[model samples]
Target chain A: MDTKTLCDGILDGQRRALSKAITLVESARADHRVQAAALLEALKAAQASPREALRIGLSGTPGVGKSTFIESFGMALVREGLKVAVLAVDPSSARSGGSILGDKTRMELLSREAGAFIRPSPSQTELGGVARRTREAVALCEAAGFDVVLIETVGVGQSETVVSEMSDLFVLLLAPAGGDELQGVKRGIMEMADLILVNKADGDLKAAANRTRADYAAALRLLRKRPQDPDGFPKALAISALQEDGLAQAWAEMGTLADWRRAQGHWARTRANQNRHWFMEELRLALLAQLTQAGPVRDAVARLGDSVASGTTTPALAVQSALALLHP
Target chain B: MDTKTLCDGILDGQRRALSKAITLVESARADHRVQAAALLEALKAAQASPREALRIGLSGTPGVGKSTFIESFGMALVREGLKVAVLAVDPSSARSGGSILGDKTRMELLSREAGAFIRPSPSQTELGGVARRTREAVALCEAAGFDVVLIETVGVGQSETVVSEMSDLFVLLLAPAGGDELQGVKRGIMEMADLILVNKADGDLKAAANRTRADYAAALRLLRKRPQDPDGFPKALAISALQEDGLAQAWAEMGTLADWRRAQGHWARTRANQNRHWFMEELRLALLAQLTQAGPVRDAVARLGDSVASGTTTPALAVQSALALLHP
Candidate 1:
């Protein structure tokens, strides 16, 4: 379809059109990129007023029941007449040959819901590309009138941090364990989290779940409170996806936090800051790409890098030589 | 002094010459930078054979007794007839107007020792500058026949990670505390550490110190082992810097780890990789500097940044517009 048709179909909340638009954005081809940009611009222009979905970034270690929690929580949201979209940013999928959310069967209930849409994106060997495409997809979903957009990433490496940049609320899901398991959670990730939900809180794990929740609560209290958060925010709660326990409370807490942020103007401010950050980041990446576009600059970088590695020249001196090649 | 005389003095292990050279490297003036590069080149050329020092990066939060530990450790090394150098990288000092190691009286005994040399460097508004200068200082110390160089940084922020780039080993110093305190320690810094020492392990705090050490030991074990580390590496131990306990043991462990790395060829490989990393980083910073230099491009960046922040256009599109201004 052409850009107008794609924009109209997306604005009407057509699943096929949304999927096609996302695929276009994810494409590496130069021509597809141009078309994708046009489609997005058309969508943005077509809207009488901006429609924004609550972008929730969710991250968890492998086997943390992320899909189960999402399925249950998404079902709850859809039951309230909310349109939900789930987008996955699995950078590892490019290397591992499988996206974590590649199989829709994992969220069978949510997938069957008429108000829910799910899509998984591959990293394509660069995190910046993945993030940019995913962010664009989020815009497409918002244009499709989704009330909530869930961005999921594995709790490894820097992907969660990247996800947080595009999200209004960042949630970390964890399996119930003692302090040992918490150690596996990077403090940097913990610091980024607005809410931490300890899954598998039912059956034999209930007591352990409570303990982990308390531990994280204490730990969160020790962290310097961010000005964006209201009082008693960034706390942990225990939930069981299988039992459907604590979902309501979790949802309520999320709503409260979102409402407070919106009231306090942090929501708009944060989105604006995020946009500025991505703009600068994209510009930097584009500039760097110029040096590596199958040119003499690339060759010079390699040659100087070898010299640096061999200790024949200092990195500062090597950088001076490289910059001279660029500016000359 | 001229570069030739400076090189000769450094090679002769003159403290005055080493201090002057470091000041030159740390200067922001263009002329001084050129002179610093010349002096460093002279020293590198003058070395008949590479005199490598065991570069140890030490970091801790304020009040972690870093100075005390360094003092005792330096005295121990000096007692064994080894020359030691301590370099501080305090990024906050520039803004705070107080260097953590500005007062030589903090390490009174070590400061008076003929075998020890100490210097503090300010961040000067950019971490890249601080890291570059500190790395150069490390080279100067090695050239001056120091057997060991300790690069110290406050445990907050990215300074420790930066110091780790220039050091052979990274050590984290912590005061006696429970799991709650450990939660305050960013996991990224912990992962970078090869050794963790719980300081103030004497008097009333000894028991707590031992417990903290064990906790970190467990946490370290849970972290994936790096290939460079030998078996049972990245361990934590308790020590009393005030009482001078465990200093010898810590030194012995460091020596063993360093010797193993040298024997296994990781030492040279790591340094080469570090050099390559720095070369690329410097090149990236230089390219970015070009964009910020006085020109229409800088003005365009500011204008486009405002537009992006206002959400008038998408970041990708904004980047395209910015890049057109550069490459057109």
Candidate 2:
């Protein structure tokens, strides 16, 4: 289908069209890139106003029940007549033995709901490219009338932080444990989380989950909260996806946080800053792409890099020489 | 006067020529930049290989006795027949009600010694420029036959972190403190520190210093050691700058760490990486300078930025438009 037809179908909330459009954006083909950029330009013009969707970033370790929690939480949102969409960017998905977001089997109930849409993470080599595409996917989903977009990232490496950049609210999922587990958590991720959820808070693990929540809460209190966070610091709570317990409370808190952010001017400001941040990043990436594609520039850079590595040429001079080559 | 003459004096370890050359590097005048680059190029060829210098980055909070510790440390190194040069980058020097390196008062004895050379932090507005100049200053010092370069950064803001980028060893100094104080420390900086020292261990603070030392030692144990770290994890020690206690041990440890890094070949690899990193950073800065200085590009960026802020244009599109303005 053409760009107009696909965009119209997306605006009409057609899942298949939205999926196809995402595929176009994710495609690495030169011709497809041109078409994808044109489609995005059209989409931007179609929706001149700011989007109202709540973009929530979900992150957790491999077995932290992220999929289950997201499934339950997604069902709750869909039950409220709110459309929900899930997109992931898991760089390690190939090594971890699955297509990115191949957990459609686990999200079975939500998958059956018409209001719910699940798109697996694209199996892309470049993390930045994948993240850019995922962000564009969020915009398309919003255009398709999805009021709640959940982005689940395998929170181990650099991708988790990138996911947070595109999110309105960042939620970190953790399993209940004592001792070393707390220390094992990356301090960097903890600082980025807007909310922490201790999943699997059912039966025998209930009390342990509560204790874990308290410990994280205390740890967070010690942290200097992000200036953009709402009045209170990051809050921690417990939930059980197996029993579908506390799912309502979790969903309610998400709404409350979103509302608070929107009511204050922070929501708008944050989005604007995000746009500028991405603009600079995209510029850098594009420049790098250009440099690598140009034969003479590429050869010079490699030779200069080797000289730099051997300490024969200073980096400043090397960059100057490379820039000279570019202009010449 | 001439670049060639300046190079000769610098290679001959003339302090006057070295100071003049650093001033040239720090100058914002266009002609000076050209001359500075030429001088650096000449020096690079004059010295066929990378010089071996022990670069130590020392950081501490305002009242944590950083100056006192450095003075004692510098004097001890001088007594050991080592030629020492100290450079600093303090962003808060003005608000802290002092000149950059105001501790020159406390360092009077060391200042009088012919073996020691001290350069105060330049009052540059941009932190990156200051850092760049400081890195160049280190090379100049080495060219002047200074074997030990101690970079003392006011640990309040971003300068401390930048200082770490240019150094072979990063030492974080903290005063005697309780659990709360440890929690108050920035986790990111803690991760970067190669060694942690609890200073001011004289008089009644001795017991508290030891306790703080043990606490930090345990905390450091919890952190994953950097792959570049020579052997064990970051070690914590207690020292008294007032009484000159533990000064010898601290100085000895610096040598041990530097030797370990060099023997493992990490020293050369790290310097290469740093050179590359700075090269990229310099390119970005130079590009930004050009973009802003060009009237059409600057105006276009401002207009696009305003549109992006109002949510009318996406960051990707804005960047593309700006890039077009560049080429056109």
Model 2 ranges off by over 4 Å: A1-14, A27-33, A45-52, A57-66, A89-102, A122-130, A153-274, A288-295, B1-17, B23-35, B45-69, B76-82, B89-99, B122-130, B152-274, B288-295
Q: Which ten residues in a row have the lowest lDDT in candidate 2 chain B?
A: B285-294
Best by DockQ: 1
lDDT of 2 by residue, A1-328 (tens): 8999998888888999999999998876646766776777787788757456899999988788988898889998999999999999787665666855466887999989999999988877688788878988998898898999999997677888889889999999999988246635588888888899999899999999999988888878777677667665588888898898888888888778888878888888888887776766666566656555647767777788878767777766776787677555
Residue-wise lDDT of candidate 1 within A1-328, one digit each (tens)?
A: 8888899999999999999999999886657877887887788778878799999999999998998999999998999999999998877787886764464888898988999998866557688888888988999999999999999998888899899999999999998888556647788999999999999999999999899999888889887599888999997999998899999999899999999999999999999999898888878877787666677889989999999998998776787788778766
How well does candidate 2 score on lDDT at residue B85? 89
lDDT of 1 by residue, B179-208 (tens): 556646787998888999999999999999
Give the TM-score of each candidate: 0.72, 0.71
Which candidate has the highest TM-score of all? 1
